[model samples]
Target chain A: MSLFVQTLSFNYTKRSNILNDVSLSVAKGDVLCLLGPNGTGKTTLLRCILGILKINQGEIHIGGRAIRSLSARELAREVAYVPQATSTVFPYQVLDMVIMGRNPHLGLISTPSSRDEEIAREALTKTGILHLENCLFSEISGGERQLVLIARALAQQANLLILDEPTANLDFGNQARVLMIINDLARQGYSIFMTSHFPNQAFLVCNKVAIMNEGRILACGSPDEIITDSCLSDLYSSSIKVVSARILDKPHKEVKVCVPMLV
Target chain B: MVVAIFFTSFLFGRYPVTPDKVMAILISKIISVPKSWTDTMETVVLQVRFPRIVAALMVGGALSVSGAAYQSVFKNPLVSPAILGVSAGAGFGAALGMILYLPWVAVQLLAFVFALLAVAISLFISKIIGGSSMIVLVLGGMVISAFFQALISIAKYIADPLDTLPAITFWLMGGLSKVSNNDVIFAILPITISIAVLYLLRWQVNVLTVGDEEAAALGVNINRIRLVVVLCATLMTAAAVSISGIIGWVGLLIPHMARMIIGPNFQLLLPVSLLMGSGYLLLVDNIGRSAGSVEIPLGILTSLIGAPFFIFLLSKAKKGWS
Candidate 1:
């Protein structure tokens, strides 16, 4: 099953609407990349979907259950979210930090199970950071910490993984690596929904793209169909163009989410 | 670990008894052996030093656990029970109680109530400034701390200098003197129960440290969890400050020390903190009684020792532990 929101809307200050009549269906194993600039309600939409923010005028259904009807743990079992990167105050070891994802699956009386450790270890191994498991998270590099966050999400074992700015502070290699990881996970049957400022990254990784602007979806379609000069020009409110590119001098790249402007 | 602390305390008091004798006395006491009609060592083990030892253990565990919880709730590392003004405010109340010649139970309860009042005022001020945000709570804690310190100063200024002043001063310094079985039971029972309860929900505390929104996203009832944690933590803190009269650094330093040892999982950190805190307090108490005829206050001893050890640990470890 997949998650769907019907006419979702949220207002800030109970006056101006931040999300207006947002409707979307995320099918199983679908990677829906929400491309938007800052304050375009991308994070707000994610919060509404995760039940962190209340939807003012519409309903959100996850796995055929209403968002409000499901318990927090039950909802967590369905949707795992990776939040924006903020500094951790304490010097918690990586193992302890990742093990917190097992909380939703546990009973009130049970501690983290052996299965939880195996899952965390597998996630860490998959992310190629298992060697750093004993090290403190605060002392890790930004890229490694980003991977640790993904591993924590993987340990959650939810079907739908949501991430906000997963590669916000990463270098070029780590950004590509994070996108590659998400692409691989999607191919392996995990539904991924993420927001990103890098439109090209979304073009390289996402199967479907929805561009949002001013609290509204400007366009939603396949990358090649929606990543057009007209849409980019209107969404970013600037002159933009996407040209064909070559890989090894073979004219093959057709869908480029490129926005080259000198302003 | 508590058992380890209890045994160490029983064996290493001022009236020195062998570990073997301490163990034998403990076994006889538990097994109901016929009373040793003439052995003073047995009385020392069972009656005189045992209550003091138990009191220190409870106070240490209670204060440190409260510290851990408050640190997590406030999302601030430097916060302790005293930051919410409970400890200092309770000192003021206890000083007032002493001046009034109130009974011991009455004085203890009065101090405990005043501590609760102090925390309530902090909570109220946090609300007044749109709390549930980390910065606001931290500010509220600072304000409450300042307010209570001023009140304590007033009490000190007005209290009779000869009898009450000295008593009040020593009480604020924290000692295991005047410890009784009843006081131990009273102080420990609530704290033990609260610690157990908080331990069961320890992961929530770790989640809270992440943030309110992120924690809410993880399916925690953010407000409810925060409230429960704060109440349970402050309750134990009030109980502890009432009995021990404001032991300081155990609450501030023990959790961080335990984090260094076992990492920062609250599940492991909780038990380690309890054990280390109890053990350290008992050790300091032993040193205090042994060093001089006049027993040193446990608070002074902890600050005197913990501060230097903290600086030493900071210097030796060069990676991200400040």
Candidate 2:
């Protein structure tokens, strides 16, 4: 297992628990998508896994070492986090932005060397945006910026990647592009943990899916085994349907999609 | 360029010294050159001009570097070295010392101590109110600054009009006319060490501009780095203000100019701000002393020049900052 959490519980204050005994695991090459409605402790769980928030009870282990026993640098070597795309105050170049991933590897007083730049460039190439290396990050389009952030996470050289809504603000085409990259990274044997509001996206990319609601994990399994009409409708308190439909006439390709019905 | 400005500054004082004579006087100290200049001229060059020149450079570089570091750490381009109320506290301390008839060294000491106290109070208040978020810290600073400013007003109000009042008023205007060799030597230690520490941590400061959680995710210790930057900046700012008496614009303006030229890479920006700030204050001080028979206060002139030029820069360029 690349990541394992056991009976995790957390609360901001002592009164109300935000996460209640949530436990899950991600093994190598597994793309685990956490699906939940708004304000359902999905982001809270991610924060706990990233060690940004301390869990009130339970233990988290990454790469077989206890999270509490690892220093920030050692933990960064095991896991990388990709935050949602946002503008920066300073107009850093794309290469400079990506090279910041090498910070965990460098000494306190040291800067990124030529070797680090090479690694950043290689990551950029892997994300298919190497040509934006010299452009200002603020000058790029939204989709390119998303790719740049992914490149930065790739440059961190961690085996486990945790992303918070990687396609949250992107348009449809960019969403597809980001999803394809996520699928490709999982194929290359990296363990991915991501949260999404779109259940249709889970069927496209994620091998494992977990549905969370009101601080609890309702179900956890492979997407094909866990994603059903009634489970999603109960989780979101809306009428939804899961249907398999054929899109092509000549070879008869079928896909499962989650559709919400309006009253 | 800094060296050229440094040497050129010696020619513009009240008692004029020729260029070659200035060179011979400087070189004679190093080697053995014929002394053609009079004793009074040498005294003016060595005693008056030399200490003032060194003081100007040190104070200017210290203020600018601290300003750049503060801006990066706060992630706010508008922040200055006094963002945490160090200047206001130091100003009040100096005013109180002068009204009480303290010695010059004692005045500087009070100012430095009070500056640190003010920042400590601001941090305490911020932590009590809303943790260490940047907005609350800034608000805490603003409240403390206003409180110190009121204290300064009270100190000035109680002073004798004929004696202590004028002295406090002049000191508040901010000038290096009283900077002696001892003052320069006293301030150089903290200023140099602080600037050196900030320069060494320049790369880590860059990591901070990516925002707190992001920097932490990258394995940079966010709180530790913020604390180090705040301490170094406060130390250098307090030292500079203790000696120079609240010269303002160099801290706020010079870093922006450096960013405009170098595009905000702290590795280059910190050093560039230092050099530019040194040359800038040297020129400003030259103009202050020689541009008129009676010296204009440095604090007044910096605001006079810094305000208009800042407005012009804001209108002209929109690329360096977000």
Candidate 3:
């Protein structure tokens, strides 16, 4: 197993818990998608796994070692994060932005060597953005920025990638592109964990799916097992329909998609 | 440019010494040349001009680098060294020292201590309020600044009006005239050490500008790095303010100017700001002394000159990368 969590609980105040008894795991080369509505403790669970927030009760282990025992540098070398795109005040170059991922591998006073820069460039190329290496990051489109963020994670060279709302602000075409990248990364033997509101995205890319509702994981299984019409409707507190549909321009390769039914 | 300005400044003062005579006096210190220049010339060159020039350069570089460091750590391009209440705290300390009839060393020491205290209070306030957001820290700074400013006002209200009041007023307006070799020597160590520390950690500072969550995600110890950088920056600002009172605008403007010339990479920006700030302030000091018979205070002149030049640079400079 690349990541394992057990009975995780968190609370910001004395009034109520934000997350209670959430447990999940991801093995190498597995893509796990977390599906939930807003404020459903998806972000809280991710923060707990990242060790940004100390959990009140639970245990998290990466590669069989307890997460609490690992220093930030050691943890960072094992798991990389791709945050949702936000505008930076400074217009750092795309290459420079990617080069920042090398921070975990460097010493306190050390800087990125030419070799590190070469690796960053290689990551950018792998993400199909080599042409935009010298462009200002602020000038890039939302989809390109997402790709750049993935490139940065690649530069970290971590086995497990934790992405928060990777396709949140993207257009339809961009969403497809990002999901494709996640699937490709998973096939390359990397462990991928991501949160998304789009139910069909779970069907599209994830091999494993978890549906969270009211601060807890309501269900966890393969997409076909968990993303049923009744389960999604219960998770979202609204009527939903699961139907088979053809994606892309291909005549074959039909896939299941979830569509919300009006009240 | 700083060298050229330094030599040119030697010639432009009210008691004009010719360029060759200035050069001879400078060289005579290194080698035993004949006594061609008058004793008055030697005294003006060595005593009056030397310390003033050094003070201007040091204050300018220290303030600008501190401003740059603060801007990065706070992740706000608009922030300056004064954003943390250091200047207000130092001002209050200096006024209190003056009221107590303390020596110059006591005044400086009090200013440095109070400066650090003000930042500590701001951080403590932010912690008590319970958030890691930058806005909380800034709001805490503003509250602490107002508190210190009010204390400085009370000090001014109670000070003896005859000699001490004018002295206080003059010190507050900021000038290099009162700087002696001893003051320069005292301020240099802290300023130099702080700037050196800042330069060494420039890459880490760059990582910080991306914001706290991202910085922490990248494996940086955000709290530790920010505390160390803030301490060094506060030390430099307090040392600069101690000797020159509150010379504003240089800290706020010079870093912007440096960023305009070189992009916001701190490895280049920090060192470039040092050189650019030193040259700019030295030239401004020269203007203060030679522009009229009465020397204009540095605090007034920097704003007077800096504000318009900044507007002009804004018009002419490139967009947002800085």
- Which candidate wins on TM-score? 2
**Model 2 lDDT per residue over B178-201, tens place:** 998898988999999999998889
Better of 1 and 3 by lDDT: 3
lDDT of each: 0.81, 0.91, 0.89
By summed lDDT, the worst window of 10 consecutive residues in model 1 chain A runs over A248-257
For each candidate, what is chain B's TM-score? 0.93, 0.96, 0.95
Candidates sorted on lDDT, descending:
2, 3, 1
What residue pairs are clashing in model 1? Answer: none
- Candidate 2: which stretches are off by over 4 Å? A249-251, B320-322
Task: List, residue by residue over B108-181, the lDDT tens digit for candidate 1.
Answer: 88889988888888888878787466577767867877877887888888889998888889989988877888
Can you give the TM-score per candidate against the true fold? 0.93, 0.98, 0.96
lDDT of 1 at B104: 80
Interface-residue RMSD per candidate?
1.9, 1.3, 1.4
lDDT of 1 at A185: 89
Candidate 3: pairs in clash: none
